[model samples]
Target: MTEPEVSDSLKTFGVVLKALRDETGLTQEEFAHRVGYSPGYVAKIEQGKRFPPRDLAERAEPVLGPLAAKLLRAAARSLTRKVGLASWFHEWAAIEEEAVSLYAYECRVIPGLLQPEPYIRAIFERRLPPLSEEQFESQVAARLARQSLLEERPNSSFTFMIEQALLERRLGGDATTDALIDNLLTQGARRNVEVQIMPLRQEDHFGAGGPMYLAETPSNQWIGYFEGHDSSLLQTDRKAVSSMLRRYDKMRAQALSPRDSASLLEQMRGAQ
Candidate 1:
C-alpha cells in the first residue's frame, strides 16, 4: 500500500525530533531501546511516516530532559494547526493556551480538557454526521493535544462546574464513563484545578445559558467564549464578559464543592 502523505506541520515536528535525538548522540536503535520502542517505529516517527504518541514524549523526558517536553509541545501545536478545527474556535484555542485563569460551566458533555482518550474517541464516534475515519483520528489527536495545556500551564487556575446529569448520563457507556470519572477525580486533586458538580435536582441555576468558558488573559483582561454545534462567539465586551463571569461564580457556588465532587465521582466509579 502507498504511504499517505504527512502534513507539513508533522514533517516539521519530525525534523525537530530528529535534531533533538541527534543532540543526544543516540542512533535510532539506541534511542528506541532507551524509549522502549522498536527501531523501525522510531525511524517511522522521525521520517514523519507516523505521529509520536503522547506517552512517548513522557518516556523520552527522562532520556532527553526538558528538551523532550519542548519537542512534545511543539509537536502537539503542529498537529493542532493542521487538524482543521472550526475557524470560530481557533481564537479561543489560542487564548486558552495563555490563560492565567479558566472557568467553565458545562451542561452538555464533559469538558474536553478533562476527558480521557477513550471517552473522547467515543464522543467523536457518535457525531451526528459521523466523522470519516481520518477526520475522527485527527480530531482525537487535536483534542488530546489541547489537553497538554493542563500540564503545561501549572501556574494557571482551572475551575470546571459540570452538571451532575451529564455524568449520570454516561455518554460513553459504563467502562468509558468509569474512566472519565476516574480521570476527573485525578485532575480535581490538583491544587490548581477545581472540579464541581451541579446537582441534577437544582431547579434554579445560573448556567441556563448553556456551556460557557471564561478566561483571564495574561494582561488580566477577562473574556467569555460560547460555542454551539458549528459556531462560537468570543465576548470581549466588558459587560458581556462580566455577566458570564458572574454566572460562573454563581454556578460554582451552587455546584458541589471540590471535595464533595470527588466523593461523587468515587461513588460513580464504584457503581460502574
Candidate 2:
C-alpha cells in the first residue's frame, strides 16, 4: 500500500527531530524511553506520520536540554501552519499564542475565543459562498484550537469588549444566543479574563473603525491585527500599534464595567 502524504511542514519537523536525536548520540528507542513513549510512536513522529503532543517540547527539556525545547517549539509552529487559517492571519495567530496580554474590540460578532460551538457553526453557515463539509469542519477545529491559549498561559491576561448590539441581535436564535452568553459569563469569571460590553447607547465610540485586536508580545512589543472579508493586516509599526492600544483603552472606558457586564448578561439570561 502507498504511504499517506505528509505536509511539507510536518516533513521538515521530522527531519529536525531526527537530526536532534542523532546529535544526542542516543538510539530512537533510548530517546523514546526517556520521553515515556513507545519506540514505535517516536518513529512515527520522526517519520512524519504523527504530530508531537502539546507537552512534548517541555518534556524533552530536561533530557535533551534547551535546544530540544527550541526545536520542539519550531515543530509546533510548523504544525500550526497546516491548519486551515488564512495565510494573512498566520503570523498574527502565532503572536497571539504567545501574547502576554490581549485586548479585543468587536462591533459585529463575539470574539472567537468566547464564542460557543453553536454560535460558531451558525456564523460559518452564513458565509456568502458557503463552506463545503470539509472546509466548515476545518474552520471550526482551527477556531476551537485557538481557545487553548486562554488556558495554556495562566499569566496571560485577556480583555474582550463586545458591542451590546451583537448580544441583543441574537444571531443564532434564542437558544444559541443564550448558550453563548452563558459561555461568556463563565469566561468572564476567570481571574485572567475581563469581559465588558460596549453599550449600544454610547454616543462617543473610539472603535468606529470596526473590529481590532491588540496583543503584547513575549518580547514586550505590541502588535495590532485587523481583518475583513477577503484580507487581514498585521501591524508592527510602533506608532500604529500604540495608537490602537490607546483607542482600545478609551473604548474600554466607554464600555460597561466588568461587574455591570456580568449583570447585564445575567439579566439577558433571565429574560430568556
Candidate 3:
C-alpha cells in the first residue's frame, strides 16, 4: 500500500524494530549487519521513512526470531484493518493498555477513555455507515473494555480538559447527556482521575483549534495523538509533541479545577 494508507503501520513497525534494537543494545550498523540490510536502509526504516520489505522481514526473523515477528505481524494486521483508522491508533490502543499516565483535551465529545458502554453504543449507533447489530455490540464491548484502565488497581493517572460546549451538545438527547455527565462526574471522583471543564465564555484558551491527547509510556516517552475525519496521527516528533503539550497546559490553566469541574457537572445536572 501507498504511504497515505499505510503510514501508521509503517511507523508502528519502525517503533517495534527500534525497540528491539535498543533492547539488544545493537548499533544501527551492527543490527543492519545482522538483518542483512545496508545500515542506511535500516536507518530509513527505523526513522519511518521506509517500510520493511518481505526480504527484510525474513532477514529480521532470524535475529528477532519468530515470537517478535509474530506479534509484529498481528500488530501489522490490526493497524491495516480499518482504512480510515490509522495504524498509529492500533499502536496507541496498545500503549493505552500499559500507559502510566494519560491526558486528553476534547472540544466536541467526551474522551473514549471516559465514556460508558451504553453511551459508546449510542455513539456507534449514530455512525453513517451503519454497523450491524453484532458489530455494534462488539464495538461497544471493546470500548467498554478500555474503561478498565480507570478501574484497575494501580490505575493510570487520567486527566481530561473538555470544553463546556461538548456538555451542551446533548448527544443522544437530554437524558443521555445527563447520564453521561453523571458518569463522568463519578469517574472523576476516582483517585487517579482529574477532570476539568472549560466554560464556553472562557477567553484566551488553548486547544481552540481541535482535540489532542498526550500519553506517557511506562518508560516516560511521550507521544501525541490527533484524529481527523478518516485517520489519526501519532506524532513522535519532539517539536510537535511539545507544541501540543503547551496548548494542553494553556487549556488546563483556563479550565475549572477538577473539584469545581465535578461541581459544574452537578450544577448542570440540576439545571437540566
Candidate 4:
C-alpha cells in the first residue's frame, strides 16, 4: 500500500518538530514534558497521525528559537489537511479527542480503537464489495491512527468490554489472534485503560442490542455512536445516550474484571 494519505501539512510539521527534538537530544517523553503533552501524543504529532494542537507552538516556543516561526506556520497549514476517517466517523472521532472518558462494548468485532494492525488488515481483506487498494490503505490508516488514542491521552479513562467469543473467532488466524491478545494485554496494562471480557457461557448476557460506543465530554455531557452495515449515527440525544450508557455499564458489571481478563488473555496466549 502507498502511504495512507495523511495530511502533508501535518507531516511537514512533524518533520520539523522531530528535527528540533533531535537537536535538543531529548526523548519523546522528555520533549513532551517540556511542551506539556503526553509522550504518546507527541509521538503521534511527530508521526503525522495528529494535527498540532492550537497552543503547541506557543508551548514549544522556548525551545524552538528561530524554528518557532516555522512551526507556527506549519501548524496553521496543518488545519486544512485531509484526514483518513470516513465521513460519518469524523464527528465521533472529533468528540473522541475531547472526551474525558470513553466506553466501548463490542459483540460484533474488536472496537477500532483496540484493533491491532494484522487484525485490521484481515478485516479489510474480507470486505464484501472489495475495496480498492487506495480505499484499503485509507481505511487501514484511519484505524491505525485511531488506535493511538489508548496511549495518547493518559488522563482519559478508557473502558472496553469485549465478548470472549470475538477473541475465539480468530478472524486473522492464530498469528493475528496472538498479536491481538498481546496488544490487548499491553493496552490493558495501561493505568488509563480497562479491558473486560464477557464470557461466552453467560445465561444473562443482555447486551443483545449490539455494539456500543459512548463518550463523556469534559463538560460531563454524554455522546453515543452506533454504526450499521452502511451508515453510522452519532446520538447527542440525552435519552439515546443514556440508554447506551446504561447498557454499557450493565455489561461492564457482568464482564470479567480487569485482573481476571488479563489472566484469561494470558491463558489464551499460552494456548496459541
TM-score ranking of the models: 2, 4, 1, 3
lDDT for each residue of candidate 2 in 1-272, tens digit (9 for 90 to 100): 12234467767777788888888898998988787655765776688654555566776788788978897797777573454466677667656766789999998889998988889899999987988887787777777766766765667899999999999999989999998999999999988999999888998989888899998865688989998986989888999988999999899999999999999999989999
Residue range 1-272, candidate 3, lDDT tens digits: 11222357667877888887777688998988786455755775676544454344555677777776676566555333322332445567655655678889998678987886557767888887897776666556556645656765245688888888988888888878878898999889999999999988986876767999888875687888888875788889999898888888878988999988999999999998
Models 1 onward score TM values of: 0.72, 0.77, 0.69, 0.75
Query: Model 1 clash pairs?
Result: none
Instruction: Residues 167-240, candidate 1: write the lDDT tens digits.
Output: 88888788888888889998999888999999888877887789999998766999898888788988999998
Candidate 2 TM-score versus the reference: 0.77
- Worst lDDT 10-window in candidate 2: 1-10
Which stretches of model 3 miss by more than 4 angstroms?
1-88, 153-155
**Which candidate leads the pack in TM-score?**
2
lDDT of 2 at 173: 95
Per-residue alpha-carbon lDDT of model 4 for 1-272, expressed as tens digits?
A: 22346677777778888888888788999988877677877887788776565556767778666576566666665454465566566567767865789998899999888888899999999998998887888888878877767766889999999999999999989999999999999999999999999999888877999888998876689989899986899889999888888777778888999999999999999987
